[model samples]
Target: MPSTDDLGSVVDAAVRARLDDSGQACDAAERFIVADDLYDGFVEKFTAALLDRRSGAPLSSVAAAGTLARQVAAAVAAGATLHTEGERRGAHFPAGVLTGLTTEHATARQELSGPAAMVFRAAGEADALRIANDTPYALGWYVFTTDSARAGRVAGGIEAGMAFVNGVGAEDAELPFGGVKRSGSGREPGRPGIEEFVGKKLVRTVA
Candidate 1:
């Protein structure tokens, strides 16, 4: 993960994709696992970018906002550092970032269905992959690295259904959209996805 050539692009893409749909998308990135070499700088820049672009947009519902608020509080209570804007107001959930989270924390495994992200400092590529795959849910994963071989290796190692490398907005009807583990059981688009909702019955007519 430390092979990143452009932190600016990584930060930009991460912010846009994560905040898209008010950070409520099932595939939105909720956890950021940065290599120890680039963890602090990435966090500083990513947080600043998040705060700058955050629109204070209301979530899908008041209850949704309340749920996110509670999740953030629980993460903090679990010993994760929080950087957020004030507090929740109605359905508006402030974008925030949680740091100092280890794989042992319950918040590390839970999904934040709002404009909040958790960042973990990884020892290196192996640790980064470990952290990325630590959760039970594995819908989507993003990798930013300049090394082509490392990129391919990391992409293959990620435990998600879809792995986007060095970019975002890869979702399309042509691509199989789904996740492994607790995220879901089947695909929803592309070739394989078409079979997820269809039932087949054998009909034989003797001629």
Candidate 2:
């Protein structure tokens, strides 16, 4: 078993390494001092019991999965760019495996399940629509509406590149997948998804 002091040192080293890799440089004194403080704070909040080896009250894996999925989906809707780094962890699985599996451009309507759906429902249509539109990774977004007619109107009002009526993950090859803002620089799937990887050259024609 690693001593508390040893664990603290390890976390400190990890933080320093991350900062260094990100092109950050600080005096060793500052790094050590700050790292110690952060390590202490972390330990205070998260003790050895929280460690993977320790057993405690169990968490619902289903709920955990739902929460994670929703968070990822929300990030996508917010126009955030999703990229992969390091050893291609499971976090990259969704975007990597799903990107080209379907049409060139497709909208994924992911229905919230279990507690996740309740969370989404609580957000109300306006908030839900806003989250859906603002997320960067969204090709299209959907939520089940109490009123299909109302949902149709609301979908039309949404600013997302695409919107679905009480539907989730309804993507079409002919359609486009992209988001506004920080979602990414361009679209994917269809001509847009293709354009992300290719550049255009304009030719001048003289008659």
Best by TM-score: 1
In candidate 1, what residue range of length 10 has the lowest lDDT sum? 1-10
- Show pairs that collide, candidate 1: none
Note the Cα lDDT for every prediction shown: 0.88, 0.35
Score residue 178 of candidate 1 by CA lDDT: 87
Q: lDDT: which candidate is best?
A: 1
Model 1 residue 74 CA deviation in Å: 1.3
What number of clashing residue pairs does each candidate have, in the order they appear? 0, 24
lDDT of 2 at 147: 57
TM-score of each: 0.93, 0.34
lDDT (tens digit, per residue) of candidate 1 on 1-207: 456878988999989878988999898889988888888899999999998899667899999999888888888898889987777889998899999999999888998999999999989888888888889999988888888898899999999889988888888988898889998888878888888778989999999
lDDT of 2 at 112: 23
Model 1 bad stretches (over 4 Å): 197-207
